[model samples]
Target: MNSSAGRDFRVVAVQPQWHAQDFTSAGRFRAWMRSQLELARPHIAGDRPTLVVLTELNGLPLVLRGAGWATRLGTFRRAATALFVVRLPRTLPLLLRERVSPIRALQLADADTNAELYLRTCQALAREYGVYLCCGSAPLPRYYRQGRRVRRVPGVLTNQTVILAPDGHLIGATNKVHLTPDEQTGGVDLTPGDLNDMHVYPTPVGDLGVAISLDAFREDVLGHLGAQGCTVLLQPDANGAPWTSLEGLPPDPAQLRDQPLAWLDSSWKATTGGRVRYAVNPMVVGNLLDMTFDGQSAITGAAHEGQPQSYALTGPRGGFLALMPWVETGPPEQLRETGRQLAAGSGHPHENLYRTGVLSADLHLPPSRVTPPTPTAHEEALAALLNGEGEWPRPTRSGRPAAWLALLGLIASLTWARRRRDGDRGRACAPGQRPR
Candidate 1:
């Protein structure tokens, strides 16, 4: 709906709030998402973001929440459940919804296998939504637990993404390269892929790359994407604020200190000189006990002649940043040349083939859209933590006297109970001539 050819392109990036608790029920979650979409409608209607990206588990969370009986049972039993049975049936039902499982939501392997189905979903969403969607990574079938020849039917990782046109056409996809230890340890059981081989998609807007949360932190991954003719990078992240508990008050003073921002600065600077754009959509809030996505969705880089400029969006509750319009200023060949030149200029002691060019952008440029927010109590606490303003309520040490008393009381009570029990047993045994 909104065009960005002549003036600075309006590239709006939004980090939608995510919830794992609601994932099991798609219908309820869809309605909730529609409401969230409504909150974002102002941006969509105003900016017409050619490529709109939601955080990981956007719609799938609902499917995950309302998981079919099969997934629930398989997950519960920790067994190799048939992927096709939970997803695709031997026969296609008149209604596709009844048959396809979350595992078969969209085919992820080999671009040819079910690429059209994948594309159609993207196309449909694009058409219906009137915007392009850059999907986050989802799980795809990879060899899990060596030597276990479980039926490796159709399946996808939960961290995968599907990019769609405003008309919902499939554009391109990037699987998450890095998996957290917990994820790897969990039944997710996804193997690490060669991130150095990054994929780029040439879209109506520009060449874009999708990088998931942990992968986004990798310098090699970002550099690879930049080198592979990718100018726009979409990072749908799952990282969030670490809280003590799900229901526990939003991160206490000490807890809020855990948010990581250093990696972001390094990641952005990694592809600075190149004509690439990077956008990160991290889930800020969610239902998991320890996991809570902290929204910091942003768009950076304008592929100008000499240097590329960058801008980031700072807002609360998944705010929207201005659309940094798509402009074809640097060709892939030029980018390679620039990369070579920059790498050569920055002669280091070590010969690193991956040291591409670096450029500094005037990121202070005005954000296209800005909305001020009223901080919640939790946010206020987090702000204190960020500012290093508040003191962590130190744990008060318990008195030693109390511990001694407790130990002595416990010994006394146990001894008395033991003696009483023994006496009763002896009396019973004597009267009955049998052990009681």
Candidate 2:
């Protein structure tokens, strides 16, 4: 591949701390974001259109800061319990009600005042910095326009990742398709966006694709993006406690390299066969109320010929990693070979580490010939099942009889218990004259 065929652009991924105190004041949150962007500005090189990526749910603090005492006191576990199990029976009614879903209501009540502030701040930062910005992820209410008024519908919320061009234009918005089990249990009740709907946003550097944390884990999502000619992947993540164990593990360089590399291999390899050349994951750091975020923000690529390697930041440090001017590299086979060497410990783990604070590299775009395998019929069927499509198996008429019997049994047991309770009360009343 000709070196001149490649394009050069700067990309920065940031990991930031979200303190409880910051959420108490909206100005503090905006100030924090501005400071982070200013810090990243010195690292950005060249006049090439740069792309800056942030973590998921980063904007949620704005909503939290504006929420009432009830919501402020509600932890992730408590919110999940109330939203999922407690509200399951009321799902239908919530959906039917006009803008009355609990999640929507909470977001509306808390975020209504600050949502615009958060978005405007991001847009302002992007424009001021002259870079494309993946502002971060937030669980926001979905709205529809009715005549002159725009209203949020009930029972619908989207975990949205917004992309802003350097000119402050809204380039693209990708909603998360895969929701974690906890998100479902927490009464998040977010409507999943279509994977097919995600499109590549063209930039001077290359085409960019954005995915939320869990969404990045899905091969289908990455595969589709690859097919669409996206050469760069930006994932904003917020995988915190319980789901990730960051308890006692030291942030040793080895541990950092191993953990994130183990997870990044699939996506990196997928990029080898797809149009994606590089992937940047900026994860959340620090504790948010009850949840502690694990931060190992990284940039991985098959850019080098010897082996595909990752440049990662360990521990819960908040910083940015920049990659400038992408170059075209060798075939996908070289990437596979690189992976093998790394796994075998032949490749140097720390070769790409620039310093404690920054990691800069010349990214290589995968050869055009590398193509992902086409899905087979069986795989397609399994995909449908995994995506929750098609009709589920229904109970037969014979099963209905058993269900009816169970219901009757429950009713009879309740009635008997009630009569026994009444008899005991009557006997107690009659014996009242004799005093125990």
Best model per TM-score = 2
Model 1 whole-model lDDT (C-alpha atoms): 0.39
Clashes of each: 51, 5
What is the lDDT of every predicted structure here? 0.39, 0.52
lDDT of 1 at 268: 50
Question: What is the C-alpha lDDT profile of model 2 across 1-436, one tens digit per residue?
Answer: 2134555667677766566557556677788888778767776666455677777877765544633342454364343223322223332233224344444433444433454566677888988888878888777554443333334444456677777777776666777887763354233445676786677766554577777876776778887887777787888877553111212221221232233334444344544444467777776555455554543566665434223233232121211233221111344445333332322123356211111122233344433332323443322332232233422222112223444444443443344345544654654221001100
Give the lowest summed-lDDT range of ten residues in model 2. 427-436
**Candidate 2's TM-score:** 0.61
Per-residue lDDT over 1-436 for candidate 1, one digit per residue giving the tens place of the 0 to 100 score: 2124322223345544443444445355545444444444455543324455555545433324324443443232111222222322221220133233222322222212222223334444456667666644444332221122221223333345656556443444455666663344222334455564346755544566766766665667777776666655666655432211111111122221213223334335434434354443434333232222332344544323222332221111121222221111254454324332322122433212221111112122122121222333322332232234433222122233544434443443344345544654553221101100
Candidate 1: lDDT of 308?
32
